[model samples]
Target: MLDSGAVAEPFEREWFMRHPMRVAHDLVGAMLVVDRNGDQVVARIVEVEAYGGMEDLASHATMYRVGRETIGSAPGVLYMQRSYGLHTMTNIVAHE
Candidate 1:
């Protein structure tokens, strides 16, 4: 039998602590705009991937800590990085 009032495990606490945005709750439908040197671009954010901080290989967290390195142009904000040295890709974040 298990104790009903047992405290959450470390990993469980960490998981719960993660501030993830639900795809359906936050971004089922939304628009995104990008402007570079007077070039205006626009599109809707249809998909996203959440990297749970530094541990995630697909996240900037591993590369550097928040508010420290110039992580990239989109620090802390979710965005896609190009892959295979090919064409541009797309992504989004739950940053406010």
Candidate 2:
């Protein structure tokens, strides 16, 4: 479990209820704070990516059944992906 007790604020919750493109744009410069094993880890969100819905051919939600369901989950849910089995990427859900 995260030691920081990560919880969404009202403003952040509002942001998550919008379209992915909007959320992606607004997320730039945002801080991602996580408490890893009692150590605070912080990172700035310099880059953000927004994928079209399940119909988009390039979207994971379109290629995998699990991704489809995951993208549709409640806002603020964290989604993670592995890149070429080397790098780990993270995403947050935004639904209108």
Alpha carbon lDDT of each predicted model: 0.45, 0.78
> In candidate 2, what are the lDDT values of residues 12-93, reduced to their tens digit?
5666888888989999877787888899877778898888777778877886665787987888888787766798888788
Model 2, which residues run further than 4 Å from truth?
Answer: 1-11
| Reference-based lDDT, residue 70, model 2 | 92
Clashes of each: 0, 0
For 1-96, candidate 1 gives per-residue lDDT tens digits of 334474432122222232545432444345555679999665655665555444557675565354123233332343455545695555433332
Cα lDDT over the full model 1: 0.45
**Model 1: residues with Cα > 4 Å off, grouped in runs:** 1-18, 23-25, 35-39, 58-60, 63-80, 90-96
Displacement of residue 94 (Cα, Å) in model 1 is 4.9
TM-score of each: 0.43, 0.78
